[model samples]
Each structure stands twice: as C-alpha cells, then as structure tokens.
Target: LHGCSAVTYKLSKDNTTCLIVETTATASVSYTNSNRQKLVATWPLGEAAAISGQCESETKGQASLNLTFADYWVHMSFASSGGKASLAGIELFVTVQNGSRFLSPNSTGGLLLTASPKLPLSADTEHFACASELRLPFGQPGGSALVLSATKIQAFGVRNGSLSAKFATCALDARSSVPSDSTTAPSNTTAAPSDTTTAPSDTTAAPSNTTAAPSDTTAAPSDTTAAPSDSTTASTDTAAPTNGTSTAAPPTSAVPTTASPEPPLLNVTVFNSARVPCLRLQLRASLSILYRLKSGGNATVKVALPADTKASGDCGNSSQTVQLSFMQGWRSDLIFVKKASGYALQHLAADYRLSPALFPNAAEPNANRSAFGNGTYFSVASGTAYYSCRSAETLRLDNFVTMETRDLRAQAFRTDNSSAEFAGSMEQCLDDTPIDNVVPIVVGAALAGLVIIVLIAYLIGRRRHSAGSGYQSV
Candidate 1:
C-alpha cells in the first residue's frame, strides 16, 4: 500500500498472493515513488530518449518488488490459484496526441526469479471472484519476483477492449441534503438496471452495502464546495432508500464556489490500471471507446475505478463532476454528467485522485439509459472478444494475435469463418489504421498520377509538332 505495486509473497511458507486489478474501484491505493527510482527524470544532450524497466527480488520468505508511475496512475489486482501465488497485474497505458508520444520507450521484458515458480489459477475457482483495486502511477515500471519453494502467480493481465473513462468530480459538502421521509423518495433510491452482461436478479445487492449514503444527484456539481461546519461525511455506507429521489440541483462546475472560472479539464483516454493489461483507449472528444472481438484464455477486464463524479438536477449549473467510489458488478452508484448525452460514470473510492466521489445516488443516465449507470458495460459484439490496445497509431504487444485467424469480415455476403472477427474488431481495433501518413500518401499518389499524365501529353505533343513541321517544310 505504501511503496510497492505487486502483491506480497512469503518464500518461507509455500504461500503466494498476487494482486489483481479486478475492475473493482474501492480500496486499492498504492504509494508514489517519493524517490524516483524507476525512471531517469534528468536529461543531458542525447544520453537517452527515455528509460524504463522492471525489477523483482526474492527475499528469504518473501519477495520485494518496486514499481513507479510517472504522471497518470495505474490499477492492479491480486489472486491465487494452484500451488502458486500471483501478485496479480497492474497495467499502464498512455495515448499520445498527433505530435505527442506515449511510452516513448515502451518496453515489457522483465527480470525473472531463479526459484521454482507457483502454478496459475485455472478456471476451477468454483466461481470465486477476487475483486480489488491497486492504484499506482502511470509511468511506474511493473516488477514481479518468485521465491524458491514458493507458489507461482500470473502477472496481472492486460488486453484490448472497447472503453474509455469519463471523469466527473464533485464534493459532498455535507449529509443533510436528503430528507429521511420515505414518501417523498422514489420507490427505488438506486438506479434501475438495463439489459447488460448478466441480468442481475431483481433483488440486486443494495448499493448502500457497497459505499457511503448516496448524495443528491439533483444538486450542483460544485455542491462539494465549502466544507460544511459538520463536514463529517459518513465513512461507511448507509443503507440506501428504496428508490429515493434526490432533490439536489446540479451546477456546471465541480470546484468550490469561491474557485476561479476555469473548469476542470477532463482527460478521457484509454487507461489501463489493473493486474492485467487492457486495450488502448481512443479518446474522441468527450467520449472514449474500445472494442474486443475474441478471447482465447480468460479475458476478465474491468478498468477498476478509484472514485467518481456527480451533478444534481436541482443544482443551477448542470455541467459538474462529483467524485464517487467505483463499485464492480451490480452494486454501485450511477450518475450522468448530463441527461441529454449518454456519457456516464462509476466512482472508484480507492483512487486517490478521485476520492471526492464517495457516494452519489440521484444521478441517472443522460440519453442512453441502456448503458445504465457509470460502470463500463461489458458485452460481446461478435464473439468472445479479448482486449487489445492501440494508443493512436502504435499497438500494444499484449494485444498481438498468436492464435489462428477466424471471423474475418470481408463483406456482408462473403462467408468467411476462417478469419477471426475478434482479431479485426476488438483485438485489431486499437491499431487498425489502414492509412498511415495519409497526407503524404495522398499527395504521392496524386503526384504520381500527374507525372504519368504529363509524360503522356509531352510525348503526344512532340509527335504532333514533328508532323506539323514536316508538312510545312514539304
């Protein structure tokens, strides 16, 4: 929790525990590299463009690993299977704009342990799911070490997928916004679920069991403004009302009332913060997107959230970000940045940067309620798609396809089962830019055509001129 990002492993005992970024947002917090050990920040002339690597060391009964994130943070999880223990995966990805660069020195090969490794957890857990969050800096290099006579653990996995994060941040000034009277509240305090991966039973686990009491979604985004005199926000979650309605009105800003006019610029890109690597995020305006076409092994992915944002309808300004804790599966609060748009949010309380959004209940989906609340909706578009990634033009190695090709879509009428559609959709979606350096290519193609036409015209003109001169001389 303080320094390292990988799970702890005790070599003395034959026990192993891996950290898995299981897509759960609450409770995962990693410390920063107060002493920049993972990267060389200072630069001379051209000693090196950028530097990065992984370090893992095994001690007597345990192993020590150090990871560092430069700017943005990362997410990870831990899980155990067989006689081995894995620290789970903490993945990091960066998307550079046209002139920008990400992972300038993107390298993945890591130092391995000399001791006998542990076994991986196969799909025989009896449906036991380990959901946790591990937050680390974005530029932190991932490190793992195995001990002798120690159980083996798999590195947290990362794959390509179709998703991007929308960040909303708000401050819960106090808990007195909502009244306890039951009649004025909606029959359901929580948002109604839509058609998604699993049709959660009608008796969905109450959201209150997962986080603090819900905040008024109708309040302004900046309601988290001045700290209240009794600013004691409930640390634990209170049982939510049966569909209680939030009377709070939302404002456009997320900062305090006395704050300046500049809004909090949101960075919506492909973010991988977990035990397993996820696909690269493609940020298009306020919306970020990814798509996975297939999966060979198990590609269980969830961009574990640290916190969330909120904007109450009653708030004078509508554009606001209220931070809330992110909850996995069917248990979590869902808030819409705006009801007219489909972008939504799920709070990840574990994330240090987004701790403000501990609980927000009144917010609902903007336009696409089918997307439901804030959690990233996981589904299969064409096949059992595993995640792949591409930040702009560059592709991620974790996303490279090693299996046979199938599900290739040539034409709607073309029957091509031999090709993998997943490889094309989710897997290949990240770096499938058919046109690279389009400007030059287009110009080159046009220039080549122009040259050919000009050459032909010159030849034809010479022949005609020669004929005319001969006729005049005759």
Candidate 2:
C-alpha cells in the first residue's frame, strides 16, 4: 500500500493466463513478459479505460478489477495520474498454475502469496512457488521473509552458491487458510515446493578461535576467531586524526593487554573411504563458539585431499581454497572438480539429484517430484555436485549436498496437528560417505591361500613318494 511511486507485482516465472488486481486507488496498470519487457498498455485504453471505471473509493478493499495478462513476470505497475499513487491495499491474483505457488516479495520484505488455480488447493498435489527475481535488499537479515497464515507450505530460499530466487519443499499440508487476495481464489493451497534444494555442509571440526573472517560479503562469513593469533590481535577501530594527519598507535608494550592464546586450525580430515577414489568428510560444528563475520557468517570446514591429488571443480572455483557462509539460501559450490588426469568427468556426472533420505519415503513421497509441507526439515540428498568427470580412473565424487533452514525452525500448521522436526544442526553436512566395497577380497584371499597350501602339500607328497625306497629300507 505504501510504495515509492508505483506498485508492481511479478506474477510467476511461468506464463500467466489471468490476473486480478485489487487496489483502493486509481492508477495506471501495465504488463511485462517473462523477459520483463513491457507489453502494450492494456489496462487504461481510450475505450477500455472508460469502461474499466474510475476507482474513487477512499475505503480499504473497495475496488476489485480483473485483467488478463498471458505472460510471465506480469509486472503490474500502478501509477496515479496525479504524479503520486496512494493505495490502501492491493492484492494480485494470477491464473498461471504450473502446479507451483508464487510467494512474491512485498515492498515490506514480507512474502505476498500469489496463485494460479487459486488457494486452498489439495495437499496431495505438488505446489511450489517460483520467484524468478525475488531477492532481499543488501544488509537485510537472512531471516527477512515472514511466514503468514496464508503460506501453507514451508518456503526457504535456495542460494545454489548463488543468491538465486529458488526454494525446495518436502511433504504436504495439514491446515488451510482462506485466500484473501481474491474472492475466486480457492483455499488450502498449502503444498511443497517443486524444486529440490541441496543442504549446505555442516561446519565440522569445531571452528577455531582464529578462523578467518570473510572480506567478501557475497562469500561465506569468516569462522569465529576466539583467541587472537600471535601475528594479529583483534583491535577496535580507532578514530581518525584531525586535519588529514595520521598518528601511529602506541606499540604493544605501551598498552597493557591480555595474552589470548591462539585458536587451533580446523583439522579437516576424511572420515571414511573405499578402494575407489571416493571419500567422505564429516562436517562438524561447535555451537558454543559463535563467530559473527561482517559479510558472510563463518563455519569451520576442513578438507583433506589424497596424496599428490588436488581438488578441481566449482567447489574450488575461486581457487583450490573456498570459503563457505551459512546465510539463508546461501550455498557453497560443493561438487568437486576432477583433475583431467585423475578422474573421468562423465563418471562423476549425476544421473539425477535427490532429496536427502534423512526423512521417510512418505515424508518426501516422490523422489522425482518435490512438494511443500509444514515443519523445520533438513534434506540430505544426492545430486550433481560440483565435480564433473567422463569415466572411471577419473575423479570420483561422493554425491552429497546439505539443506537447512535459515531460522532453524519448523512451524506447525494451525489447521493440522502435523509438524516436522529433525534433530541435528540446521547446518547439516551431506558429504558423500563411501560405501564399503562389496568385492569378496577377504574371502578370495582365504581361498587363494588354501589353494597354495594344498598344492605345496601335493608336491611334497610326490617328492617323498619318489624317494620312498630309502625310508622303507630304513
């Protein structure tokens, strides 16, 4: 209702068939395609404008008008003829249901629910919302989106190592909320999201007191550095000198300071491995030692590579070294890049990514289909990680990704008695743990040893028989 100059609502990433705009002010409306290019002025035309009726109501919820925009990102920009637009309340309804719901970002940073076939739909169906360009403004808390009663499904943004407007959901609805956006809008649209979001790895190995902080806001935040290192000590910023003059701070000897021991380096080691090139790294975290990095938050993660083998993939895109932050929808590219000489890119390619099996099959009923439900859930699924290979003897990756909630919370539906709660770090680590090789190596070795012993006995018997005359004479 309170906006700078116009009120715009982007309907969905998919093409929209119908749209109903409800507002309390007289303003011009426009539309845009999937690419955000404005279409012809459809709302206020010479003949249509007169018939559309001028909304002169000052009361809230007084005007309800419907328009048809058959495109994606149906940007309905409302501008008043008086050079300023004042809307008491606005509701946008779209008829573009790709079996997914749309939770658009409102001007107030809360999510505004938009639907195609309308709300209060069944829970058995797949319903995920897609916000192609949904993003939070800079410096906004990761917990910006608010969960309203209208939001039937659990929604969390997926960063995918990039802050893209994508979310993943598992399970379906229990309670139902009546749709307030439109009268025709159905109720009970609570469903799971369609897309699959992999969880970020947990910060295994208690974060060291001297963990590095992220200088880049986009990158993961720095691990909590408790005790200052010998080389660098945590110091407060000093005031600038007057008249553009600079003054050097007193030496350490001049000021009394506590001697803080340095924190240890995170020991990132592999937990398990097989004869094959796959290995698993357990992501651990210490909840007590919390570090707050300016740009991205910090988690201590360590990785140990095989002797003479270096990692090469999107996980190590910036360098062989990568930093991970735990912001909502924040993802660190985790698939390992296979060295050309080490592993075949094709071998490491994933068939199809899947949600983590930490939950029951009914919890995430369909492996191929994604849905929304209530509860705070974490997914430990396998999918195309950062690694790419062609064939064997090439780099092999244990396909694993971690999914967690930003709030580390699960809310119960008001209408349903159902709720989901998983124990462990919302910052779960889904590393590919190598399964033990099922080749009968130990059994084969025992058989081979038996065969050798029998052969040796037979040879000795034959030799003794050839020399039997000497023993018989004795």
Candidate 3:
C-alpha cells in the first residue's frame, strides 16, 4: 500500500483490469484524475454484505479482479479495510482471457507479495445484501466476473459497472463469510447461495460442517440448488432495489453559481421644450440623454436631429455612428428651427479625436475655436415623436426633445414605440416681439427730437432781444 491504507497507481490509459490479491478484509477502491485533482469513482467494498468480499485465494489461487472505464485516466487508488488486510500484489493489463497469466497471481512477472499468506476467514455472519456503497465505475462498463464452483461455472453479469443478478450473491458475501479456519476451510464453500434465507441455514450447519472435515460435503446440492432459485429471484426482484438505488443517485437539478449575462437596453424621450411660429424664430434646443451597458465595449451610436435644427457641440452626425466607449451618456445644446407645421434640428458633427461617453460635460462657449481639437462627439440613437412650432419667449418647454435606447448593440437608440404629437400651431417661423411694441418705440423717439429743435430756436431769439436791449444800457 502506498499510503497508510491505500495503494495509488498511475495508468497510461483507460479500460484497465486491476488484479489484486486481497483477503476477506473489507476495503474501498477509488479512481481519481490527477490532472484535475478530482475524485472520479469510489467503491466502498465490504460495507454491505452484497458487493463486498474477497475470493478464497489460499487453495483456489489468487483472485482475478477486473474494472473497466470509458475515458483514460492517469491515477487510481485502492484502499483496504484496516482489519487484517493484505494485498499480495496487483497487476495492470488491458484484457483478460482464459489461461491468461492475469488469471493466476503466480503466473506472471509483476508486482506481487513475496509470501502468499492464507488469510484467516471472517467469523462475522451477516445477511448477503447489495452493498449500500456499491457504485458502477465511470463510463458504465458492463463487464462481470463469474463465481466458479469446483465442479461447474456460473455466469454473473456486471450491469452498469456494478455486480448485478447472480454475481451479487457471491460478491456480496466475500467479506462476511470469510472462513475462520483457513487451513481446513473447504474450497467448495465459495459457491454458497447469497440470499437472506440461505445465510441462516449455513450458519446452523457451520458447526457441524467444521466437525465433519469433508470440505466437498458442505458444497453439496444444498447451496447449488438454492443458488439457481436465488438467481431467479434476483432477476425478478432486482427492480425494487434498483428503484431504491435511484434515490441515492446524484441530484438532477443544481443551481448555477454564476449569473447569466444581460444584454444592453436602449431608451429615448423627446420634449417639445422650445416652440416658435413659422416666421424663422430662433428656439433654444437642448439634447440630453443617458446611455448604459452591462458590459464594457465600443459602440457606434447616432442621433437624428430635426431637419432645420442647428447643432455644434455634442450631438454628432444625423446618420453616422460615433464609435466610442460610450458607457454612460452625452449632452449638448441644439438650435431648434420653427418651420411650417413642425420644427427641425440641424445635423450635429462628430469629432474623431475624443472619446465618447454618456452625459458628457457641456462644452465651454467658443471652446471649439481653441488650438485643442473639438470636444468628444456623442450621438443619440434615433426614433422621435411629433415636432411642433409655436411662439414662445423662452425655448424651455418641458417635453420638446425626448429620446430613449433603441438598438441593443453598437447604438443605444430609442425603440420605435415611443412617439408624441405636435401640440404647437402650424404657423411658419416668426419673430416673437409684437409689431405694436416696435411702432410705439419709434414714434416716441421722433417726437422727442422735434421738441429739442424747437427749444433751441426759442433760446436764440431770446439772446438777440437781450443783446439789443443791453446795448442802450451799456
């Protein structure tokens, strides 16, 4: 054993047969993936009367053990029960056929125990039931080893890598029925039927059989006849245990540890904040939008302005997509134009030099004229409601320009479902100041100039009269 109670081996490939020379000591065999450091399979032997036990190796010869796998692994380990457990030796091979050296422990040059010790038989007498720890090997190999009688051979099947059907009878009893006295142990005793009913009958006869000294006598028709009956019952009754076994199977539904990825969403809203008549009125227009994404990536976004609206600072090209890290948003001032029934926004140009972002800082007045490049360009995604034209002193209407996200990818454009109707009049753009106000201001200025001219003439006449009168007095 490599460790305190286990033997670990490294194999080149899969589908290996582990030929172990073990006594009736209970043990557990397991497989592991060294690369992944993961436990692959574990078979707790001798825990249950059923799939646990070692064959009678003293006189009959070393027992042959075979296990199969689907995928190749690099490491495997075998652990034995702490009780008088002895591993004579073990051999790794691909396949086993009749007369093969693997069939006998003494036949080939391999890892082997220097001395073959006859293990003392187990005195424990337990009902032979399927091992609770029995598990099929990985890859579900359907191979089996037969329990042979000195007179004949009985076939047993390995189903889903676990010993099933008649084989379970002998295999399950391998541990509990170890002969207490090995030198006088009967060779034929291995063929005893493994069943709840036959277990008691053998115990009652164990004392008498020990006194009789005829090893072949105990292996007589009693066990052979009962073996077939038990096999038949095993074939029919196995379903019950299979159903119970399923209860112990791995859980089918497990919650995932990591969260699923979420895609980006686009939103757009328009407010008719500024409205003017069709008489070429200048309306204050502002574009403010927020963009958000779950992941960090470059995106191409574009926001279309009203046809006549003028844009300079942040709003980029009407149709061209601005490529940027645009995680948050962009904001800018726009010139809204009042036309016939609706309003228009001029196209905003993009600056290729700067990075794009959501909620960009407002540009400083005349900042673009400096030697530095035009500030970063950001474009809103499209889709807007109705445009309006109305006369107003201030362009600050609550809901004139609105936008939302639309394209889920490169652009955060508003969905088409968002819409609004123009609430303003259909008149053309006009000056907001009234004509009456202008006429009054012009008339008042003319009257004041005429009065000043009259006052100057009066002063000149008075000065001449004073001069004539003063000449006589001087």
- Candidate 1 lDDT over 316-363, as tens digits, reads 012112222222221111121222322222211111111123222212
Better of 2 and 3 by TM-score: 2
TM-score of 3: 0.16
List per-prediction Cα lDDT, in the order shown. 0.21, 0.21, 0.21
Instruction: Please give, for residues 77-168, the per-residue lDDT of candidate 2 as tens digits.
Output: 12222221211112221222112222221101011112121112112112222211121111122211111112112111212222112222
C-alpha TM-scores of all predictions: 0.19, 0.19, 0.16
Candidate 2: misplaced stretches above 4 Å? Answer: 1-422, 425-431, 437-441, 468-474
Error of 3 at 10 (Å): 60
lDDT for each residue of candidate 3 in 203-257, tens digit (9 for 90 to 100) = 2211100000000000000011111100100001111111011211222222112
What lDDT does model 1 reach? 0.21
User: What ranges in model 3 sit over 4 Å off?
Assistant: 1-286, 290-438, 472-474
User: What TM-score does candidate 2 reach?
Assistant: 0.19
